[model samples]
Target chain A: MPVIEVNQLHKRYRDQVAVHDVSFSVEEGEIFGVLGRNGAGKTTTVECIEGLRSPDGGSISVLGLHPARDRAELRRVLGIQLQASELPDKLRVAEAIELYASFYPSPADPRELLERWGLGAKRNTAFGNLSGGQKQRLSIALALVGNPRVAILDELTTGLDPQARRDAWESIEQIRRGGVTVVLVTHFMEEAERLCDRIAVIDAGRVVALDTPAGLVAGLIGGQRLRFRPSIPFEDAVLTQLAEVESVRRSGPHVEVTGGGDLLHAVTSALARHQVVPGDLRLEQATLDDAFVALTGPAAEN
Target chain B: MNETASATRTMARAPQRRAPRPFRALAVAETRLFLRDPVTVLLAIALPSVILAGLGAVPALREPADVFGGIRFVDYFAPSLLAINIAVLGLQNLPTGLATYREKGVLRRLSATPMNPSAVLVVQLVINLVTVAVGTVLMLAVAVYAFDVPAPRHPVGFVLTFLLGTSAVFAIGLVIAAVAPRARIAAGIGTVAFMLTQFFAGVYLPKYLLPEVVVRIGEFVPPGIGAFQGAWTGDGPAPLQLAAMAVIAVVATAVAARFFRWE
Candidate 1:
């Protein structure tokens, strides 16, 4: 059964619809990605699911329990790491961890959690004194302390260094391997592609596309793209003679060849037959970035 | 198989785990934080003591037909200052602290946990009450030993007034904390309210010396006006007035709770 099921979830701030008729289900132990640009209503939708914000319309259930109606029960089994939350400036890291642990009926040992997150060394440091990455790690540690069955993480690596981001990704994968369902909301296409089992692309408060990253790329791009910097300027006759070349387009000095199966070999054979070789030959598989650009019309500046 | 059984045992033991320790932990943490601020500590202790000493030094501050019937100024103002101390902590410190927490997103983070918002509020109140109690005791000690203030004419009346007055002001502070747009606004409101109480409620000045209109206005304001009747003048007003004030406090607390923003 799906650990979290949200159907036709709708929320509005004043007259502006924040989330409009959104729906999705997160199966047990799956890393589900809710990918969207900033202000795409991803956070609002997830917040409603977490019982932090009451939905204006539709129903939400986590582990078959209504999140709003059964908030205490839901909170007990579901952990959340909000994008921007803060602890008191004077509160020490260890104290903050222990305090959050004490809230639950049963919680992971604060020491163990600290050790796991490599935050044990800075346990006595005040929250405000910690670096940005340390604070983010602490937030993640707080979310896991409840040993929740389902964890929701929003903007997991918005402001982390590359190494910290990689570490976080590994930690998330480990969490999923441990049989905990995760709902990851992120704007990073690479992060989503690497971690998510299924990706839901949200745009303007709606899911514009939903599929596996590879599937979405394959389905959206239609065929493979061959990019080459030709040694000699090519004529239409040279391109039309290639057997696998379905279409061709040129911009500046670059040539793009579009076709189906074994298109790369066909292009190479045709180029060799013509005694012409490109200076830079590359076969490009469609990526989620390309798929996002195709579907959303323009890549959102991150 | 052994791991599974041990895990099952742990899960079963989880439900029977001890009650939440966040409140106690937060209280100790908050008290330590409070003490770390030297200015706050000094204000909490010095405000009442200074008032008590200053009032005791001035013998003419007492009126011949004092409301206590024959009570000295020191005897009357001591408990009034005790109420004032509670009011200062509750109305001033608590609201500003809450606003700061909201500004810093501390309360928002806590709300996301299994701990309810009420638990955080309760912890804050507990810390405030403890601090106020200590300040009250110290003030009382100084009043009796150094200042020679008379003992409570009616211990029950004094206790009742202290409890009721603290509740009322704390509720009022909660309202301010909940409704104030920001920390600056809360501080501004708290300062204005404190100054109004000091000037009009006759904390330092005699109420009889004030104009009739001002005295009439003070009749309704808490701590200063209410403390005069409740603590200073034992025969000041009927019991129903105190009851009405308590009701107002309760209503204020309800309204504050209703409008409280955990953000």
Candidate 2:
């Protein structure tokens, strides 16, 4: 059975209609990513799972307990890191950790967690004094302090520098290693691709696609492009003669071949028959970024 | 792509037990935060005694006055200053602190955890009460030692009236905190409420010398009758004043609880 299940969830804030129809289930230990554009109801959906917001229509079960009805029980097993949420300005990092830890039955050692997250030196620092990256790390640390089975992190790496983003990803990988199921809500295609085991692409409050990172890239637009500079000039039509080649273009000394499935082998055999040596051969394929743009289009502008 | 690398790294999930009482931890943290707030400490803890010292320095205030039944002016002002301390802490400090916490997302963050966000509200009230108690003690010490204003003759009555009066004002402050959308709005509402309550408590003028109509209005208010006048008379606690405070406490607490927002 899945650790978390959100089926046909519908939430409306007055007349805004934040979430129309969204459904997905997270298996016991996989990192599930909710990918969407701003205002795509990613946060709203995650909030419902966290028991922070109630759904207008649909059922949500986390660890076999209803999110709203069994909120108190569910809270014992699930941790949450909300987007744009913060601690008191004067609250020290150590104090924040201790206070959160106290709320749970048994929490991880705050000192060890801080050290693992690279925040040990900031134990005595006030929240307002920490840099953005440090603050994000602290927020993540507080989320895991409860030693919960599952954790939902909303926009965890937003506003972080590139290095910090990578560091956070490493911490998340470690958290999963600690046997915690993670539900990550984010818009960054690179982060989702790097961290998510499977991703659900949400656009306009609807699930447009749900698949593994590589599967998503392939399922959306399946193709490959081969770029090369021919050692010697040959008839361009010779390359196009191959049935696998979809399109061929030659710019100056460089030739570009675009096609899908076994196009590389067919073109290479054709090139050898024509007594041509391919120079600077390079293969380019679609990435999640491309898939994301293809799925969300104008709505994905961030 | 790194699925194999992660598969080898999975650690066993351990069954963990619940910790000891956590509310006390939160309460201690709140107390530390409350101590750090210079605005609250200055207005609620230090200013009351400072005002009392200022009053003691004036020769006219030390002279006996017929309006106060031949009691010295400084003696008459003592209990009123203590009432002002409670009023400032409740009508101003409590609401401003709570609203700022809500605006900063502290309460919202707590709600997502195992801890109830209302714990923060309760902790803040507890911390504010401790601060007011300290301020009350300091006022009493200064009045007896420095100004020679006699301590409350009716000790049990004084303590009961003080508790009821503080509850009434704190409940009203909770309502303000619950209704105000932001910290600045809470501050504005608190200030207006504080000013009105202070007026009724006779901060600007002697209560006995006030016009009969104004005195009658003050009699029905908690800060005026239950806190200040009750403290000064040190006589039998008036049943009407105690009933007024009880009604305010019950009704305001209900309103605050009904409307309070974690976000």
For all the models shown, what interface RMSD does each have? 2.5, 2.3
Instruction: Report DockQ per prediction, comma-separated.
Output: 0.52, 0.58
Candidate 1 lDDT by residue in tens digits, B200-254? 5667566546788887666556653454355534654446546755886899999
Q: TM-score, each model? A: 0.87, 0.90
Which candidate number would show the highest DockQ if scored against the true structure? 2
Sequence-dependent TM-score of model 1? 0.87
State the displacement of the C-alpha of residue A209, model 1, in Å, after optimal TM-score superposition.
Answer: 1.2
List clashing residue pairs in candidate 1. Answer: none
Those runs of model 2 whose alpha carbons end farther than 4 Å from true positions after fitting are A228-257, A261-263, A266-280, A299-302, B1-20
Write model 1 residue lDDT over A27-120, tens digit each, in one string.
Answer: 8999999988789899999999998999999999999999878888888888899889888887889988887888787787677678777799
lDDT of each: 0.80, 0.85
